[model samples]
Target: MNALYNCISKYYPITSEAWKALSNALTQIKIPRNSFLVKEGTVCNNLYFLERGCLRGYYSLDGKEITYWFGFEDNFVTSFYSFISRKPAVENIQALEDSTLWSISYEALHLLFDAHHDLERLVRIINEQYYIRLEERFMAMQFKTAKERYEQLIENSPHILHRISLGQTASYLGISQETLSRIRSQV
Candidate 1:
């Protein structure tokens, strides 16, 4: 909970009263490893703030899985489009490790927006940050070589190299595991 408060505080000032309201609104949940936070074809109505552990978002294509994103502690994990659009999710957000998360329902968040002006501002800022991250990822996928992408991934989240499986890391980098091994050897 303190982690969540600190994360929010980094972006927006919160009044004590608002903080209390938010604390009361967020529900803590434990997710076992290999559990799905958001499954494909399910509407995602909650946004999760990870307090501990790791998760990955991926989708299957022609029976092959493609990893889209990986997130660890202090990260916000969600199917943002599905949550915002109220549509079925295209990807699955799965816990890679036993995890603890603070979750707020979409309805609860909107209610908070009306009650806390600062929270509303905070959400807007968060959206902008999410967009920028998405854009960077897009550029990396479109313009960067697989090795470059792997390097960028290391720079962005070095812990992922140790925490995730080689196959999963290769999928994330859009390369074969053998290629990943080759690239790793070169490094």
Candidate 2:
């Protein structure tokens, strides 16, 4: 769990006492590739920290999976809407590779917040970062063409291509695999 501690320390430092509380709340688990972490129509009860491997968040739309985002090592993975609102999620989070994760239930997190205000602030900051990325993605989708998006993805996260299938990458870019192939060939 040193990796988790290092990641958390980069965001906010917690006292040993607070760390102990958090450690007690976290449950480490392994998810096989293609396993569902958060399924559609289910309430996401836990927030997970990806200790190793990758995951994707997607929606099943008219028989097609529309991937929205991906999470890699060190990423916090969850259905944010469902986790925060306590509502059923419209999207699913699936492991793209065999993954190891540490998770904390919503109830446990809130209890930690009550006992340790620093932990709350740390999560708030992390949520703000997530919101910023969400806004960036929204703006990119609004203004960029598919090719531009593909190019940006290549420039920003080229490692993703190596980790996930091309079809999944195409879905994340809001394009067909054929279209992605064409763009990729031209590049």
**How do the residues 1-187 of candidate 1 rate in per-residue lDDT, one tens digit apiece?**
9999899888878899889998999999999999999999999999999999999999989998899899898878789999999999999999999999999999999999999998888888988998899999899999999889988888878888899999999998889999999999987
RMSD (Cα, Å) of candidate 2? 0.9
Clashing pairs in 1: none
Off by over 4 Å in 2: none
Q: How far is each candidate from the true structure, as Cα RMSD in Å? A: 0.9, 0.9
lDDT of 2: 0.94
For candidate 2, write residues 1-187 as lDDT tens digits. Answer: 8999999999889889999999999999999999999999999999999999999999999998999999999998899999999999999999988999999999999999999999999899899999999999998889999989989998999999899899999988888999999999988
C-alpha lDDT of residue 137 in model 2: 96
> What local lDDT score does residue 37 receive in model 1, on the 0 to 100 scale?
95
Q: Name the 10 consecutive residues with the lowest summed lDDT in model 1.
A: 68-77
